[model samples]
Target: MPGGLALDTILPSEIKERLSRGEQLTIIDVREDEEVAAGTIPGAKHIPLGQLPERHTEIPQAEEVILVCRSGNRSGRALGYLESLGYKGLKNMTGGMLEWED
Candidate 1:
C-alpha cells in the first residue's frame, strides 16, 4: 500500500486546496450512516467501510479516491484493501473528521 494510508498524517493543505478547486477526485466517507449524519465533507459519497469490499464496483477505479472516517483508522484499513484490489490513486484523509474539525 502507498504511504498515504497512514492516519494522523495529514494531507498537505496545498493538496486539499487542489481538491477544493474541483480536481477530478472521489472523496469517500467510510463512516456509517449514523456517523455521517453527524457531519461530512460536502459532496462526499458515503460507502461504509464494512461494505467496501463487496461494493467496490460502485466506486470508479480511475479517479483519485480519498477515504475518510471518524478518526482515520478505518479509512486506513480501507486504503489497504483498496490497494490490494488494485485501485490506484488512493489517499486517506488523516485525522479524519477529528482533524477536519481542527
Candidate 2:
C-alpha cells in the first residue's frame, strides 16, 4: 500500500467546503437502510458496508470516493478493504455523519 493510503481520511469541514463549492465527489453512505432512513449526507450514494465487496464495481473508478457511516469506525474499515482491492483515491469521512452534522 502506498503511504497516501495511510492518509486516506477527510474532515467533515473539508467535505462541506467541497460540496459548497460545487466540486464533484462521490460520497458513499455505507450505513444500513434503517440508518439512512433516519438521515444522511445530502447527495450521498447508499451502498451499505455489507454490500461493498460484491458491489465494488458500482463505485466509480475515477472519482474521489468518500465512505461514510454513523460514526468514523465503519468507514475506516471500508477504506482498508477498498485499499486492499487497489481502489485509489478512497477517503474515509472522519467522524462520519455524526461529525458532519455537528
Candidate 3:
C-alpha cells in the first residue's frame, strides 16, 4: 500500500473471507492500464481512476464496493469521489496489490 493510509480501508484477507462465504461482492480496480497489466484481484471491474468520474455509472450500486489500485493510492481517491457521488459502501483496499501480492 502507500506510505500512509487514511481512515477508510479494507484488508485483502477480509475480502477473501467474504468471498469464501459466497457473499456477493463488487470490486472495482482503479489502476491505470499499465498497472493493471501486472494483475488484479479476480472478478474486479477495471475502471481507471481517470475514467471513474465519467464511468461511475457503470459501477453497480452494491451495498459493498471494494476499490483497488497499485498501491491503494488511486483507489483511495476514487473511494472518496464515489462517496461524494452518493456511494455508501465504497472501501479502499488497504495496501492495494502491494499487500495482496504478498
Candidate 4:
C-alpha cells in the first residue's frame, strides 16, 4: 500500500452520522446476492466482490465509495482493488455488516 491509498476503515457510527448530515456518499455492499438478501445499510449499492473487476466501471469515478461485506476482510480486499484502479476516497466499513447491526 506504499504511496497508494491505503485501505481505510470507517466505523458504522461514523457512516450514520455522515448520512444523517446529508452528506452524499456511496456504500457498496460486496457481499453476494444471498447475504445481501438478508439486509444492507440504507441506500447501499450491491456489487458482489466476484463481479467487481468486470463491473467496477459501474461505480462512479468521482464519488467516495465505502465497501461492506459479511465481514471486513472481503471489503478490504475490494478496497485494495479499487484503489489500484485509481479510485479515491475509498474506505472499508470496519467490522462490516456484523458491526453495523451490532
Best by TM-score: 2
Clashing pairs in 4: none
How many angstroms is residue 28 displaced in model 3 relative to the true structure, after the best TM-score fit? 0.2
Q: Among these predicted structures, which one has the highest lDDT?
A: 4
Estimate the Cα RMSD of every predicted model relative to the unseen true structure.
3.9, 3.6, 3.2, 3.8
Model 1, span 1-102: residue lDDT tens: 375444423463544687779876578899999999998887789999999978888888876778889987999999899888988778888778887776
TM per candidate comes to: 0.80, 0.88, 0.86, 0.87
Candidate 2 residue 95 Cα shift, in angstroms, is 0.7
Better of 1 and 3 by lDDT: 3
TM-score of 3: 0.86
Q: In candidate 1, list every pair of residues with a backbone clash.
A: none
Candidate 1: Cα lDDT at 77: 94
lDDT over C-alpha atoms for residue 26 of model 3: 90
Give one clash count per candidate, in the order shown: 0, 0, 1, 0
Write one digit per residue (lDDT tens) for candidate 3, span 27-75.
9999889988999887889999999879999987657789999888888
Off by over 4 Å in 2: 1-6
Give the Cα lDDT of each candidate. Answer: 0.80, 0.87, 0.86, 0.88
